[model samples]
Target chain A: MNRLMIELNGLKLEHPVMNASGILGSEPEHVDILVNAGFSGIVTKTFTKNPRNGYPPPIIVELDNGGYLNAVGLANPGINGICPVVERARRHGKPVIVSIGGSSLSEFIEVSIKAEECRATAIELNMSCPHVKGHGLDLGSDPSMVYTLVKEVVSTINTPVFVKLGLCDKIIESAGKALEAGASGVVLINTIRAMAIDVYTGKPVLSNKYGGLSGPPIKPIAIRAVYEVYREYNAPIIGVGGISSWRDVAEFILAGARAVQVGSVFMKNRRIVYEILEGLEKWIEIHGVSSIMDLVGLAHRV
Target chain B: MFKPALKTKTEQLSSTLYLAEFKLVEPVHSKPLPLQFTNIWIPGVDEIPMSIADYEEEKQVLRIIFKVVGEGTRSLRDRSGFFGVKGFLGNGFKTRGHDRILFVAGGSGIAPLPLLTRYCTIDNCIVDVVWGVKSSDMLFNIEKVALNPGSVYYATEDCSYGFCGMVPQVLQYIIEKEGVKWSTIIAVGPKPMLKSICSTIDPSIEVYVSLETMVKCGLGACGSCVLKPLPKLLCIHGPVFKCNEVNEFLESTHD
Candidate 1:
């Protein structure tokens, strides 16, 4: 009877829309806001082994037309920090995906087990954060490293594990390696490594000098990533990148994303989650569809 | 929403306070409001949010006055060239035609008051400012921004200025001496200062505060600048908040 409900491997989500990591799930109160905002799942800001102060100001640059350049340096409250955050989110009765980031295999396994211990619905390995070194795109770009990290983490935790990958040279190979290593799903296309230069100062805008680029400009790239990965492996996928409208969500599903995450767009419209849900509801009613998943890979057949 | 300022100017307001002016390439907040801030990025150094001291709407010029607090501000203090600027954003203060309005500020907390006082005077409201400073050198020509009945009052900790005491003590003395009901009170400064005044003051008085916190994104997407104990981000719900709106967080801070 709940048309928006979705079952992915071992995790069950209320709807197909979720908050992406690095957006607002840093504290318990932020979780409340996301829940009130009507997001079906709570995807937390990626957590590390220790507290990361991140970079100072100039961490983000909003581009002129549909893009965001950011280098937040994977700031989080640390692994133990997730206890209160997960406890608070569970009270709201929504699936909470704990995204874990690490510079090495031990850190990844360590954080993933902690997430499962905290009763996370799923664990997302942050393999493609473009800004941070050693942890993000550094490991994701190499398929063998993705295979090694995923295999080690999946063996350590019983919870459904997801591999979050960005745009890299061997993206399809990376996605395939993750699935082969026992990941439940793949989150396609983290922000691409990019930068912006201030014309006035004749210097790069962000303090880090280099950052990850996200938003509408990256949507087409994400769709291709999802479409290709689906065509090759037919694995469960969670799509994210430049998802500003409900139509964008539909597009991801047709391209074979079971669920989609929204990031930079939340900065522009806090009410977007509800708006997307309303629009999806109308689409389901109009299309006379009993299950939302029926739309997944529809574009592939056409 | 970060953009460059076309025309830039900086003036040393006091030994500690330096005022920077900019002609924005594009306005972040169309009509500027008091207590809102401009997130300034010092090229290769850091980014910081400074309270809007003044603005000329038609000219696209904005003014921010700040004191050096750390390495970031130190870099901001001496920077000569252009840097990224975002905002004139956040929920700013709204004025009601109250009979008597009192502003209690400490150090750089006085930054937002001048512009707000300007608006209060235009609405024909009686305004009084009780500002506290650590020493005399931090004090400057605030008389230009007048407060109707008693232009401005100072309480310097070093006894170099009027009323040698803390801001709250001077505030109490001013209210008792006036012997009239105050319509509103707005306080800003260090967290401890804002908390102490809020707790000691009469609960019946309407109070608003400008909170200080590290803000990264300014868009409220990052919870770096959250008003803890409450589900609000200062970048979104405030840099300015009514006492009633965030009473819980204030109460939590009291402990």
Candidate 2:
């Protein structure tokens, strides 16, 4: 059998496919689909210490290409609302990653601490949502703040801390700084800064006026960031961007992602996870590769 | 209860339309409702909510009617020639007993109205349809709907053809002139139109509105489709809701 299993901070996954945070919601109402579709792990929506209303609508806009710009403002039902989802996912016997985002260091720590009580296998610190006005990418962009945040969360939680980073300038330096401060792994490339104007109304489509872009448009940028950070730090990288198919996932793996997190694609095609896993298996068998681990960072060596 | 299923594109209806049908593959729950919706996924496109226009209980075939709205719809419409959908989601509309059912449709709102009309016709329930469009050219399959022996009214804003007025005006005229005691009013159209109809009508008369909201996951997981009052997600709670539970939503919009 082509073993697709990989290790992240001592946790073993059945496969390398994981749903990116924010894309998958707190309720696993779609878990059967995710599990049957062959995803190794599912990430819950970003949870906050308290319930947030997020931004007002039109939070999402369609770009000219098939990509999208979303400023959902991280609307979540709070940490307590996420427990049932975590329990349901655990019952399915698949790895579950709980994603938590906060405006302050204490909020982040509290949410992460709350998530530890659930059955989530790990906790992903979402210091990288670009659309929110006060939080998210702002916290991620500042290297010192990221390090301090990561160190604080990692020190408090027993579960592995995956510091999700944004694809801003000097991302490699930022990823390196995050690892130095003690992130167990890194999730590279949240949505890129973008906006869309309604030609008829002659105004921006999103309520926030500007949002973060995702999908095919960001794939190239995300792959570049993953390659740069992986080459520089050699820390486990959870590549997330525009991974819609197996080919995209393969590219991320080759670029040095230990595993890949899918967001927009899951929104577009829930079965994409299984299709990718099937395709990866087929590709591995055809190429006579013994395992997915052997393919990690193959492009970097070449 | 509802389950998510993977559906393949059996055929494309038009350049911008598709005839993709999915097998229940997995039936999360069997509901006795005439309206059902799914949170659909088109690879590399967008994820949005769509209503189940037709369903065959034995075959477990669920049909969804959608217009090419945005990136997700475009992607699904484009890739119908390639990869298809892989999720069935949301709580559908419930229709109980054979009552006088009036369907009001505008724009792509025409999709689920026809299905409801067909169901009511087969069940020998009284059915009437008021379909509106910007102009006559925007109208689709009026004959198919009119053939049911149930009254079919057409209205266009510009009055290129048919009645020159709005759907609510037509409905008001019918109720006033014919003295038709409509047991239920199910409306799916632009939010403003639905809002207008809800505001003008008496709350004692039953009215159900299929709300238009941004839906991503469609399983109530994502808060994208939440309406105020109950803070319920349209994807799971309803694409269709009784007039009272949603009066707060309509009231909030007016403010």
Top-DockQ candidate index: 1
Q: What are the candidates' individual DockQ scores?
A: 0.69, 0.06
Give the DockQ of candidate 1.
0.69
lDDT by residue for model 1 (A250-282), tens:
999989999999999998898998899899998
- Go through the candidates in order and give the clash count of each: 1, 4
Q: What docking grade does candidate 1 earn?
A: medium
The sequence of per-residue lDDT tens digits that candidate 1 reaches over residues B1-255 is 367875377778888987777777754557667788878877777778888887777787777788988987777766666667786668988776666778788998888766776667677676678889998899887764334434578889888988788887778787778754677888988777777777777777888888877788887787888777788888988988877777677767522
What is the C-alpha local distance difference test score of candidate 1? Answer: 0.84
Please give the CA lDDT of all the candidate structures: 0.84, 0.72
User: Model 2 residue A80 lDDT?
Assistant: 88
Q: What is the TM-score of each candidate's chain B when compared with the real chain B?
A: 0.89, 0.81
